[model samples]
Target: MPFKTKILFLCTGNSCRSQMAEGFARALRSGDMEAYSAGVVRHGMNPLAVKAMAEAGVDISGQSSKTVDDLATKEFDWIITLCGHANENCPYFPGKARRIHAGFDDPPALAKAAATEEEALAHYRRVRDEIKAFVQGFDINAAG
Candidate 1:
């Protein structure tokens, strides 16, 4: 019924952090924000990310993995980068989309040496919660 802020969560692969941000935003801030996510390049959805989000009662399995070029709309109120690669390589949007960088650790990379599935998932869970908190606490109006 009121104005919905448009946000784009950008990441390197669209596999984890950005997806988590988008999911958390959708589940937690849907009343006031329309969130979208994409990577500089598509790495497809990460299964571990899905599992981690499910554990938190959020479903991110329905979201897609694609490049920034894939989004139908280019305008956004905020373009938040969830990783360094995306932050450095983010494509320009012609609108008044204010950009912000909030880098998060890559779960898959962090779990690379993990000896077991549970160990690997630990990384996902941690990053997922971190992203959720960021999405919940971020003040879009604070961006300049």
Candidate 2:
């Protein structure tokens, strides 16, 4: 059997973007990759993120918000940063992990100034679909 690539998605908070990426990666590339997500700081899983994934038939409610420190001992084939903050502040990984920057807009931040819940959720949904598309088209073989 071919070995599955392990990937870690990082963000400032393990709330929206990173969580969405992990969910899509797992749902779309389970046979070729193992997906995990963490943040520089844990902000807990975003409810809107969970809701957005469910809309696309991927359930991410079981996933937890974790920190880079929590996965210190784990090794990954790739570490993808989903936000500028995480790309700048990512911790060292003691392995052959290749780092990639694929920054996505922060849904929570965009939603913060939203005038209504629907407007706020729109931000989450947009980012969620973007992340899903990125994950669906990820070049896992190139990581090798």
Best by TM-score: 1
Q: Which residue pairs clash within candidate 2?
A: none
lDDT of 2 by residue, 1-144 (tens): 879899999999898888899988888899999999999999998998898789889999999999999999899999999999999999999988999999899988999999988899899989888898889888975753
For residues 17-114, write the lDDT of model 1, one tens digit per residue: 99999999999999888999999999999999999999999999999998888985668999999999999998889878899899999999999999
Q: Please, what is the whole-model Cα lDDT of each candidate in the order they appear?
A: 0.92, 0.91
lDDT of 1 at 80: 94
Model 1: CA > 4 A from native:
none
Best by lDDT: 1
